[model samples]
Target: MAVKDAAKDEDDDNEVSAEPTPPLPTPATPPPSPTQEHIPSSPQAQTAQP
Candidate 1:
């Protein structure tokens, strides 16, 4: 019925909101930190050798 469809749609919206949103920003934010750290570390080693 109409009520059942509305409930299902609400649940699907909640699940979609909960699942993808947290993980999208999580991987995105972490990758930049590691890459920046690695880049700085490489330059630090070169600086030390010189």
Candidate 2:
């Protein structure tokens, strides 16, 4: 019975790990820059709204 219970527990863990969690947008977000790239310092740089 102990062995069976252990096997069942392992199976449950495997199923949880196998679940496909939604992809996070964290990676898509650009890293912080010392100088904001979107700032219209030049004629070409357009002002972007957050």
Candidate 3:
């Protein structure tokens, strides 16, 4: 049972690390950069708006 559970856990990890999770985590980390970049650009737009 323990061995099966460990194998199952490894399979889960492999599924994540093998495919979908890589891009998910990459995008998750990067998403903030765009928001941060947008914030700086916003001041310029605010002045233009005024």
Best model number under lDDT? 1
- RMSD in Å for model 3: 4.4
Q: State the lDDT of candidate 2 residue by residue for 19-47, as single tens digits.
A: 63323344435543423553435435443
Clashes of each: 0, 0, 0
Question: Poorest 10 consecutive residues of model 3 by lDDT?
Answer: 18-27
Q: Counting only residues 3 or more apart in sequence or on different chains, how many pairs clash (N, Cα, C under 3 Å) in candidate 3?
A: 0
Q: Which stretches of candidate 1 lie over 4 Å from their true place?
A: 24-50
* Quality of model 2 by C-alpha lDDT: 0.58
Off by over 4 Å in 2: 20-50
Deviation of model 1 at 9, angstroms: 0.6
In candidate 1, position 14 carries an lDDT of 99
Clashing pairs in 3: none
What order do candidates take by lDDT, descending? 1, 3, 2
- Sort the candidates on TM-score, descending order: 3, 1, 2
Q: What lDDT score is found at residue 6 in candidate 2?
A: 100
Q: Per-residue lDDT of 1-50 in model 1, one digit per residue for the tens?
A: 99999999999999999999999999899899889999999999999999
